[model samples]
Target: MCKHILNAQVSIRAPCCKQWYDCAECHGESQTHPLAKTAEMAFICKKCKKAFRKNMSEYEESDEYCPHCDNHYVIEAKTPQAIVGVEGEDARVDNRMLKDDRVKQSTNRSLFTINSDDLTDKVG
Candidate 1:
């Protein structure tokens, strides 16, 4: 409580956001485009504390690689991972289909004349 109150009283400084620029081809030699490269990246690792680009840059351009394990890592921009939970429900339409002696067509109309296994039975 006391720490929160003290923090609130102190002026908090917001971090500066970086602006990115196009590649060297877009602003080469005589070109005077502002900031052809970004100041810093957004996503950073806690263990390494190094900034890493999240965009679809080449593996060589990435700075988030694990030095200890030499593992390449990329952070996705568009979609994050999703977690789904399955609920208990009756998923089977009819178990009798498997027990049927005659092979039925998938469309439920008529079986095709194609030479196939399991659909034809031999009578001894």
Candidate 2:
């Protein structure tokens, strides 16, 4: 297994080209265009090539494995950190929802949703 696979840190899915790359540096080096906006990105398991929404909810299971590639991994749950949006020189977390208690609750739900078509692997 590659070191990234052993570490369980998945590769990034470039929204612009819809291809997987190791990291932002890799994308910047290999591609001519700029990186995709953070909100419009996903991650793929290095081993199995399984895709995960940015919230990473899909890989939360203790026995996480890619249904497509059957690559195994262990991902520990992490504390919720403020998600900041970076646009050129400006960086900020939209605070409009900060007043909502429900938004602060740690839950399995993701802030953004994925369309069924956005998912590459169909389990059925």
Candidate 3:
């Protein structure tokens, strides 16, 4: 439900107000005060809906996952971007997105094909 980080896997509990947010930019938009920094951080995994805490001082590579569900919560955030695109489903999955109202060539013809009747009539 976060607008800033579209692919956020976990909600971080802000040390400042103890409120959960998907990203620091989201916290900044709703809260008036700046985020507080702390060595201990709390997070709620979106997949398993479980809460866990990690001490930044003792943080390790293994701490990047939720202890209860083993869901990898640490990942590169996918933020929204400003771009122009056709307003339709993915063209790869749905061909309708790529459909255009234009004249199409016949599939049952070849340039080298010649009518034998036309040649015989001309000879006669």
Q: Model 1 — TM-score against the truth?
A: 0.22
Give a tens-digit lDDT track for model 1, residues 1-124: 1222221111111122132212222223324444333333344333454444433243355445644343444333232346796554444854543445797667533345544554554333
Native-to-model Cα distance after best TM-score fit, residue 62 in candidate 1, in Å: 6.1
Worst 10 residues of 3 by lDDT: 115-124
All candidates: CA RMSD in angstroms? Answer: 17.2, 29.3, 8.0
Residue 119 error, candidate 1, Å: 45
TM-score rank order: 3, 2, 1
Colliding residue pairs in candidate 2: none
For candidate 2, lDDT tens digit of each residue in 8-117? Answer: 35777788888777656667877999987754446687665567654443435643555566565446523335578744532345555344456564454443655575
Worst 10 contiguous positions by lDDT, candidate 2: 1-10
> What's the lDDT of the predicted structure labeled candidate 3?
0.87
**How many backbone clashes does every candidate have?**
0, 0, 0
**Residue 85 shift from truth in candidate 1, angstroms:** 11
Pairwise lDDT winner, candidates 1 and 3? 3
